[model samples]
Target: MGNVQLSLALSGYDHTRDLVEGRVATPGIDLVAIQLSIEEIFYRVAKFRDFDVAEFSFAKYVAMKDQDVNDITAIPVFPSRAFRQSSIYIRAGSPLRSPEDLREKRVGVPEWAQTASVWTRSWLHHEVGVRIQEIDWVQAGVSSPGRQEKVPLKIPVGVNYSSAPDRSLTEMLLDGTLDAVLSAHPPEPFKRGTGEIVQLFGDGGREEEAAYYQTTGLYPLMHVVTIKQDVLDAHPWVAGNLLAAFDRSKQNSLDRLADLNASRFPVPWLRDHLKDVERLFGGDPFPYGVEANRATVGKFLQFSYEQGVAARQLEVDDLFAPQTLSAYTL
Candidate 1:
């Protein structure tokens, strides 16, 4: 047959130069634009979680893991505050001070959120000894179809609020309608979006306030990629090419970020944030070249299994396109 057309998808923040180059077996190749929202792609891919598919994360690949997948690179990194630096927001002048004060109180959250809401709930219920079931959950933006179907786990007795959740959450918090709001960062509605609200505490409980509730450990917010093995088997060249191309692009992007930042994407918070993106690329600029792929895959697979997502333990080799690695040696 003629050259195969492979499809790839990523978040808006991600740079795609490497991905496109990695997949190009020759100067010219077939095309299949599979562009979609990251959430939409993830939701679609999650449907096939039951299948025995092979997958690799460009982020994990570039970070220098032990194993090899196919071509993938320039993986995206979000604002750290959106993931690690999470917090609970209450009225500025309210008596509800810490996570402990939120017990049995109504809490507002972005409706049907997968990672942020799920992590927050799991942290509160499992780690903090808080009976999250007892608290009232106001799911904001329930009417938005995109947001509605994205629920990771069921909301235990949450009220599906349809109005603009940002406004609702802020109003509720201020008017005492909501006892708390669990969000990656404080809601922006209060300040008219100029500045974000400050976090109450760091990842765990406050060092000084020993009485407050906290988490047992830091949880991963997002990092999973899956691809079908059938496609790779059909087109052996695609996988390796994609991986190598992505590695080069990630390296180039990292090195030239300062130059690219001013014109392409200007933001003080985002500047130099991707210095660690190379960590995933490992020693070489190609995916699966070094042992970094194996290390990352092993770690995340174990994490996924522990999180009760995967049914059984999958060996590192079981998830990657092995043929792709041989091509990388050249």
Candidate 2:
């Protein structure tokens, strides 16, 4: 039989470069990689089922499974992961001292079920001692107005929640209507360095994020690679093939990222930064697999459930394709 030609929509991520660029090929598969913004890919895949395989929001993936939509099955490959503490921004010169100070203050979220918001709130409640219900949560776009929750939510009772349909989160924050904004992207004012918004964790939150990792051991995950259930059913071998190819692809990027001799990526002090990352992660900066990330997965799902991002707490076993979950022997 010829290779399974499939449409794969994903954000342009360095880690998945090899797979997308044909350097690392998935066995028995002819992947047509569609590069787009993460938001666009996610919305198209979730709303329209536009691709055979796609990068999907981790929160939305879990929520889909929780709600029993069951159209897509994931592999253990996480294409996007980041420490989100730096995403929380407060108006410059605000009296808010720390995340704990967010208690009872209005906080804006791009979406209640946004994966970044989930991880940020988890860190706030679990590490910073700020409970979810103590903060008044407003849903709005970061730069534009009228952003809606892409995934339906069963908002937990007693959680102060509302919406700002006509204004952006950064707008509300600047207007004093919101004390802070927890967003995946820095507010436009913050990006422009207008002295209007500042991250609660300072500069890039590297120090604060390092502390968060020390406490939680979680380099929080944001996106997962998913294949349509119909595609998987028709080609049961696709899951394992994609998983192996993705790992190789990640290694390819890591090799380039850690290159000390020549500049593969355009980052100054790349070697120094790589050494720091290696030291922090104990040499395994980004391991891709269900078992390798069990604790992180559990913590994320637990937070997802508590925050109503997912309908219920989902197990690691329940989240991925069975073929990718464990090793098989001849």
Best TM-score among the predictions, by candidate number: 2
TM-score of candidate 1 versus the correct structure, residues matched by position: 0.53
Tens-digit lDDT track of model 1 for 1-330:
566655555544334454444432323244344555544555555443322222222223322232232333222221111233245666656666566666777777654333455455555655566655656777553112123423133223343233343445665666677777775434665346433333445333344222221222232324434445565556555555555555555555555564753655556645445544344323332233324455544544553333333334456665445644334333
| Model 1 C-alpha RMSD to native | 8.7
Local error of candidate 2 at 155, Å? 1.3
State the weakest 10-residue window (summed lDDT) of model 2: 198-207
Model 2, residue 231: displacement in angstroms? 0.3
lDDT of 2 by residue, 1-330 (tens): 899999999888888888999999788999999999988998898899999999999998899899998889999989889999888899889998777889889999999888999999998888888999999999999899988888889999889898889999888899999998998978989899898888886666888999988877899999999999999999999999999999999998888887878999887998898888888889676788889988899989999999998877788899999998897679
lDDT scores of the candidates, listed in order: 0.45, 0.89
Off by over 4 Å in 1: 17-36, 43-82, 87-96, 99-113, 118-178, 183-223, 228-230, 258-330
Q: How far in Å is the alpha carbon of 165 misplaced in model 1?
A: 12
Cand. 1 Cα-lDDT? 0.45
For model 2, state the Cα shift of residue 215 in Å. 1.6
